[model samples]
Target: MLNMQLANKYAKAIFEVAQDDGKIDEYGTDLKTVASEIDAHKELASFLVNPQIQPNAKKDLCAKLFKEELSVSVYNFLMLLIDKRREVLLQEIVREYQTLSNAAQNIIHAEVTVASALNEKQQAKLIEKLEESTGKKVVVRTKIDQSIIGGVVVKIGDRLIDGSIVRQMQSLQKQLMAN
Candidate 1:
């Protein structure tokens, strides 16, 4: 709980800084890059989060590792995290920052599952419908789930739209049993 608050604080601070500098997207990309690097290499992540490591060493290592990929402001932010001993929260911070960035850009992420991959026209139509219904730009991540049998299931935030053939068949079966 306390970690969440701290992550939100740091994320909001950097989000505002990026917004002011008109680099919200770039900073988000950099944050994801840093988080991915830490996630992909367990030893590197362990080193950063290790309490025994000196702050100076962590800061220097972070600077060296991301110097080419991150901008000056983002590099400084990494150092700040190290100094504050909050380097372990990088992944959470990145997630929160992305939430803020998406809200700022009026974007919503949707997970769409189908029995098979949607063609280009189908994808475009789905996105258009999702945007129209939500009144926000929709960014979809698609998954193929053959068990759905056909049709699609769209999940956005707390809402789930189950339009799958499997679900329909189950509903029909239940109704027939009741009758």
Candidate 2:
């Protein structure tokens, strides 16, 4: 809870800074990329969040490793976190920043999973329909789920639309049992 509170605070501050600098989109992508790298690489991540390691050493190493790769602003921003001993908040801060950016832009991310890949026509139709329904920009991410057997599942925020064949079969089985 403390981490979330701190992360939200940092995220809001960063969001404002990035927006003012016209780098909100860039910062958003960089934050997510760095967070994913930390998540995917276990040993490095462990070293980063380990309280046993001295903060000075962590700052030095992060600077050496990321100085050339990251934007000057991003590198400086990270150094500030290190100085504050809040490096562990990076992932949460990134997630919160994404939420803020999306909200500010009136954009919503929607995930659609189906038994097969969507063709161009289907993808276009889905995007058009979602745009019409939401009155906001809907970014659709598609994934294949063979286990669904058929039909599709659309997830937009907390709302889920499951029209999959496997779910239908399960519902029918449950009805038969109840009868």
Candidate 3:
């Protein structure tokens, strides 16, 4: 909880800076790249968070790895995290930043589960419907769960819309039992 709070604080500060510079998406891409690189390379992640290593050494390594890829403001932000010994929260900060960026851009993420994979047309239709209903741009992550038997289940944030055959059958069974 404490770590999340700290991450949010850092993310908000950088988000505000990005907003002012009209570079929110660019900064988000940079932060995501940095976080993913660290996650993909365990040794590098350890080195960044290791208290035994000197801050100058860590900053030097970061500069070599990301300076060319990231904008100046983002690169400086990375150095700031090293200076503050908060480099360990890089991934969480990136996530928080993405959440802020998505909200700012009026985009919402949805998880769609179906019995099988959705083809391009179907996926496009689903996104279109979700966008129309929510009045926000929709980004969907699709999953296949054969156990659902048929139909689809969509989850958007705290809301769930379950139209799966399994759920429908359950409802029918309950109604029969009640009758």
Tell me, by TM-score, which candidate is best: 3
Sort by lDDT, best first: what order? 3, 1, 2
Candidate 2 overall lDDT versus native: 0.89
For model 3, residues 1-179, the per-residue Cα lDDT tens digits are 99999999999999999999999999999999999999999999989999999999999999999999999999999999999999999999999999999999999999999999999999999999999999999999999999999999999999999999999999999999999
* Cα distance off (Å), candidate 3, residue 30: 0.4
Residue lDDT tens for model 2, 1-179: 99999999999988898889899898888777778877888887888888889888888888777777777777788888888889899998998999999998999999999999999999999899888998999999999999999998999999998999999999999999999
lDDT of each: 0.96, 0.89, 0.97
Candidate 1 stretches with Cα past 4 Å from truth are none
Query: lDDT tens string, model 1, 24-140?
Result: 999999999999999999999999999999999988888789988898889889989999999988899999999999999999999999999999999999999999999999999
Clashes of 2: 0
Model 2 residue 118 lDDT score: 90
Model 2: residues >4 Å from true position, as ranges?
146-149, 163-179
Q: What TM-score does structure 2 among the candidates reach?
A: 0.84
User: Against the hidden true structure, what lDDT does model 1 obtain?
Assistant: 0.96
Give the Å shift of residue 31 in candidate 1: 0.9
